[model samples]
Target: MSLSKLKLTTCLWFDGNAEEAANFYTSVFPNSKVLHIQRYLKNGQELHRQEPGSVMVVEFELDGHRFVGLNGGPNFKFNEAISFQIDCANQEEVDYYWAKLGEGGDPAKQQCSWVADRFGVSWQVVPTAMKDMLASEDKAAAGRAMEAMMHMKKLDIAELEKAFRG
Candidate 1:
């Protein structure tokens, strides 16, 4: 299969904190950076009604994935239906993301390695081994791992491995 030269980017809708969210995301993830920012101008104020120099959109990269954060007002909000999955290598990595992404968000939304960040974006800080364990040929072991995982918010790699072994 030939890869297309076109670069696909994910757009994150923000009420009025596109730049803040972009900065937070860049800080949390390594190899990430804010690329560009577009501001609202005077001529377009009639439609947007935003301050002339206010942020309109912030283009950023988080761990090599490109994303655009749009300051599209509060007309829309993020829900649990869609979320980004972060593949973590170990318990420490999972903990790091859980704390970083889950901070200042709705605590009630956290469940089974899934969390909503302060900006209302959902993320699943999942351990890479969890996928392999859940896909094991042994039905009983896989079931045990799933059962164990379902009970935890921030995933524990050792506990998951133990469940897989059982």
Candidate 2:
């Protein structure tokens, strides 16, 4: 399906590596695949400078969300401001995502469960339990969890729960 059909879709800009990025992302997430790839034609080759048959945009689905990766060159780059949060069902799921997504990423950039993949795309591997603790009306418990979270890179669910209960 095309991204236009969705009410909202995220589009990522890449420097001629959209295909590789799409493939990697699909491999990391289950129930995901590259939906369609749009290639540049001769008509805009003059302005775009990309080869006529080169990739222009790669449309893919990660889990259930659709995303378009555009080979728009080096004008822009991904940053820490925006990130996709993965809500894991348990500590095992959180650990799995953390290891897969954090591979070859900048260790210095990792903090509070946020990791920037090798592609420079930031992702937050959050435990599903964290939501309840953080949203709890008991501000002290929420504060404790938040404080505990601030001290860690990959979040420890047990630690957060202990802090919350204290």
Candidate 2 per-residue lDDT, tens place, 1-166, comes to: 6666536789999999999999999999999999999999999777898889999999999988999999999999899999999999999999999999999888988999999998899999999899999999999999999999999999999999999999
TM-score of each: 0.95, 0.93
Q: Which parts of model 2 are misplaced by more than 4 Å? A: 1-6
Report the Cα lDDT for candidate 2: 0.94
Per model, state how many residue pairs clash.
0, 0
By TM-score, the best candidate is 1
Residue 71 Cα positional deviation in candidate 1, in Å, after optimal superposition: 0.3
lDDT of 2 at 105: 87
Instruction: Note the Cα lDDT for every prediction shown.
Output: 0.94, 0.94
